[model samples]
Target: MRVAIVGAGLMGAQIGCEYALGGHEVRLHARDLRRAQQRVDEGFALVDRHALFTADEVRAAAARVSTAADPGDAASGADLLVESLPEDLELKTAVLRAALAEAPEAHVATNTSSLSIAAIGEAIGSPERTVGTHYLNPPLLMPPVEVIGGERTAPETVELARKTLIALGKLPVVVRRDVPGFVWNRLQFALVRECAWLVEHGVASAEDVDVVMREGLARRWRRVGPLRAVALGGIDTWNRSGRGIVPDLSNARELPDLATVAITEGNVSDDAGARDAALARELREERALGAAR
Candidate 1:
């Protein structure tokens, strides 16, 4: 399969590399030539460490990667088109419109973390051909890809996306409904908002809270969700424990009602950028080392 990844940022590069590793021809497109070249260099460097390909092999694999300044040119001859643009509705809509216009024959997938898939599809004027393939950070390492279907998304399109993602060596979780934030963000934000409330109230130190989660809850969470974990601990005990455990939000301050405000206020975590890049590099190295073994 020939895959075209629009956007050569962290997610785009990681996903493009994964497709290449899966033996598909991959091309990375960027609006900026320098960024595109930089991404290509980074991709090779990361893939080389995984030793999935030697320097020469990486070069050969990367040879399949071409950069395009124009969206239409980038999407030409693509079987699958993945858009990894910024998490802005307007920006994504514009990009999707251009991509759909350019690659009318290709299956379109958005790597949107929280946007509405239906809205995105509508913007592109082809709801049936559009689906959401939301990947966790560092796509090369994350096994689960949420295959989200919008209200207008055709069943066949969703299935094709699922099959294609599996063929690219990813585990795809099909989501029947296309809700905002989807499943992952809703679950994650629920916990995070509570954690923020806890921190704001000084109920537990950050380190301690992290310790309790990683050392205590995370181990069990791997096998079961919070509800099931509590159920296994005895539903009676869980019910009793929940009686007085309501999170206190008196001290919680609203950063801003809108996400744009929160970002402008710089309340968003700084670690996300470093963490994304580091994970990609680390995963590449790990894969390379594992291949050597």
Candidate 2:
């Protein structure tokens, strides 16, 4: 298999390296060549230090991965095309349109976390070939890659993406629709919204909130989903109990003032840039460890 990945940043490089390790030829494209090379170098370093493969295997994978000299050249002869561009809808759409224009026969995928897959596919004018392939961060080790089908996405295209993820040893979930944030973020953000409200309303401090989620809710939800947790004649109880709280749940149309103040007070791990990186790394490490088990 030949794979072309746009955006050779952290996520892109990790995903490309995974394909290379899976015996697929991978070409990573970037607007900035120096940055792309730096990421590729980091990928090789990770391959060398990784516990999953031998020196010989890492060398083989390194040989299979390469950076494209020009961005346009990346999609020239690819079997699968991946867009891991910035979160901006316009930027992602433009890149996908140009890349898909050059590789009409290639299966197209966007690693978008929130943007609507159907909207992006409409912008690309190739919805049938395009599907959302949201690779969770630390793509090299993460197991789940949320897969969503656009309004016009063909069933075969979705299956091709599933097969592609499986080939790379990834767990892929077929999202029922091309909704924003797909399945994961929808559930995740719903929890986050309430967590914020709980903090603001003085119900719990941040750390205690963490304790409750970590020791109680997460411990249970980690194994059985919420619906499954209530499956054994508990649905009636849930329905009766849930209705009372449903109206009182957080319904903020914008970010809570407390959230803004937390960040303003240096709460992204303590500030925006470093905090985000640290949190992302921690989550990635946790997911990687869980996947290993």
Candidate 3:
């Protein structure tokens, strides 16, 4: 498989590395070609450090990735063209237009965190080919990839995307309806809103919220997931509790001030390097735990 990835930033480079590691040829397109290649190398190094694959396999996968100067150059003769650029609609539409012109037969997957796939398709004038592939941060370590099709998207395109994601060792979750943030971010932001509300109302500190997630909710969810965990705990009791609790949850329409206040008033770490190291360690532990099970 020949994969063309636009943008070559954090998500782009990481996603390209995953495709390359899956034994597919990958071309990363970015204005800063050197930086893109460097990021790709860094991705492979992270894989090696985690011992996810053998040394030889890592080296071979690293060799399979190359840098492209432009969208046309990257999308040329490619089977999949993934746009991992910024979240701007106009910019993504323009780039996809140019890239798709080069590989008209290739499937289009836009890596949008929160954008309407149908809107993107309408803008690009290729509703049939465009699909939303919302890959989580650190795509290599995260297995659940959302596969969302626009209203006009062909069934074949969605199926091909599922097959391709499965081939790259990812769990492709096909979202039946087109919704904002898809599944993961929707559930994630709902929890975050409540967390923020708790902090805003002096119900809990941010650190305390982290503790509850790390020590309680996350651990239990890992074992049985949210739905099953609720089922195991007696759904009838949950229903009774939710009748009172659900009404009290945050429903602020505007953006919450918690994040802004945290950045300015609270001691939030801006050390990207240290944060990345910590995240990598956690991901490695997660992988090991999964393997053990």
Candidate 4:
């Protein structure tokens, strides 16, 4: 398959490398061609470090990716067009419009984390081909891609998105509705909100919250979902125990002060980034082994 990725930022570069590694030809488009190409090279290096493919295979995959001068150039003769611009509706729609004009028949997908796919479709005026393929962060490593269909998105387009993601060896969950944030972000933010509130209210420090997730919930939730885990623990028990906690859970409409402070501080831990990448690689290897079995 020929893929046209309209953005060569971090996500776009990783996504293009992902498609290339999946044995598809990828064309990347961005205003800053040099920076985009450099990022793509870095993406390829990251892929190599992850050990997703052999050295020879990595070289072959790298060869399959090329940078285009513009959206039209990238989209020319493409089978799929992926827009990974920032979360600006106007910017995305404009690029999509330009790219779609070049490849009118190609399937349209947006890597929007929170934006409404239907609104984007409306803006592009091609709802039939427009769908959301919300990939998780570190796109190349993350397996789950939320496939969302807008109001006017054709059923076939949704199916195409599913099939394409599956072809890339990624898990695709088809969202029935085009709700904002879809499924993943909705669940994610709920936990984040509660975490923020906990930290802000002196219930637990931020590091303690991380420890709870890393040591407790994540260990169990990794294999079993919350619902299933509850079922396993006896639904009646959960209903009796969790019912009281529901009312106390954070429901604040505004962002918590702690969260705001953290954002303002921008105190990112470089070690956490390194650890996350290492863990992602480890999980990918495990998944590959499981698939082989």
Candidate 5:
């Protein structure tokens, strides 16, 4: 397969590397030459640093990956064109239009975290080709690559995406509807909002809350998952619990933009980074334990 990635950012480069390693030819293309090369360099550095793949494996994958100067150069002969530009709607719509235009026959997917896939399709004038492929951060280690199709997207497009992801050694969960936040973020933010509200109300210290997730919820969810865990006790009890717990969850209608606030308030970004890394590591460890069991 010939894969053309329409950005040279961390996400695009990581995805390109993974596809290349899966035995596909990949092109990391960007408008600016220097930025493209920088991402290429950082991607290679990651391959060298990672403990997962052996030296020769990395060498072979790196050999298959190349760089392109522009979207046209990348998309001309690509079988799969992926838009991994910034999350801004205008930027993504413009890039998707250009890249998909270059290769009308190629399958198109975007890595937008929040934008509407249908709106993007309308902008691109290729509603059937465009799909949402919300790959998790650190795509190599993180699992569950989301495959969501727009309203006008062809069924074949979804199937091809699923086949491609499975071939590349990924778990692709198809989101049947075109909803905002999709599935992953909805579930994630649902929990996060409650946690934030709890912290605000002095219900638990931040450290203590982490323990409940790490030592309590994480253990149970790893074994049976939330739905199955609930089902273990039958639907009647699960319904009773939901009736009690759902109303008590967070009901905040608006979210404060904490990017600048967190920076000004303290080094909350650094703390968040460390905490997230710990959580990701724990998740991987628990997944391994589940597999062993």
Candidate 6:
């Protein structure tokens, strides 16, 4: 398949690399040549880190990647057109409008993290051809790609998107309805809000809270979601646990003043680099295992 990725940023570049690695022709379109080149460099660096291929192998894969200055150039003859532009509604609308005009036959997908797919599709003027193909940051490493369908999204578009993701070695979870932030962000935000509340109330220190989650909840969550984890603990036990847990302040006034200040000061304990590297390593290992098979 010929895949065209608009916006040569981190996510867009990574997606292009993934498609290239999967043996597809990929075209990366950016507003500027320098930005496109930067993304290509970053994509190669990530591919090298994973050891999915040697430098020579990456170079070969990169041969399949081309850069374009405009939407029309990238979308031309593209089988799939993916937009990974900024999260802004108006900007995305403009890009999609141009893309659809250029590649009327290509399936369109958005890498929107939280925005409404319905709204984006409306802006593109062909809602049936547009669907949400949200990838987690660093698409080369992430295994799951949420395939969301807007109100006007066609069934064929969803199936084709899923099939294309499968070809790229990703697990595509189809979301039938368009929801804000999709599934992952909502889940993450729910936990974050509570964690912030806890810190605000002096319930636990930030490090300690992270320790508890990483060492305790995260491991369990990897195997089972929260609801299933509770179910496995026995309904009676869950009931007892639920009864003891008190609800925090749902109002703005309940927010801890120092919590906001701490976050602004970049005191958040998210080990973003370590997490990204670890995930990349895992993906490389998986690719190695697949190659062995």
- Best-matching candidate per TM-score: 4
- Give the TM-score of each candidate: 0.81, 0.84, 0.90, 0.94, 0.86, 0.89
Candidate 5: list runs displaced more than 4 Å: 257-293
TM-score of predicted structure 1: 0.81
**Top-down lDDT ranking:** 4, 3, 6, 2, 5, 1
Model 4's lDDT to the true fold?
0.88
lDDT of 1 by residue, 1-120 (tens): 888888778888878877776777877778887877787677678567545456776776777777787777778888888999998888877776776677788888899998888888
Which lDDT value does model 6 have at 13? 87
TM-score of 6: 0.89
Candidate 5: pairs in clash: none
- The predicted structure with the larger lDDT, 1 or 3, is 3
Question: How many clashes does the backbone of model 1 have?
Answer: 4
lDDT against the true structure, per candidate, is 0.76, 0.80, 0.86, 0.88, 0.80, 0.83
Q: List the residue pairs that clash in candidate 4.
A: none
lDDT of 4 by residue, 153-223 (tens): 99999999999889888989999988878999999888888888888888987878888987899988988
For model 2, what is the C-alpha lDDT against the true structure?
A: 0.80
- Worst-scoring 10-residue span by lDDT in model 5: 256-265
Candidate 4 accuracy as TM-score: 0.94
Tens digit of lDDT per residue, candidate 2, span 1-293?
Answer: 88999888899988888888899999888878788878877766755654455788888988887787555688878989988888988988777667766788888888999998888888878888889999876676557999999989999999999998987778999999777789888887888888888888898887788779879998888679788988954888989988999989999876575553242333543443453444446556765897899
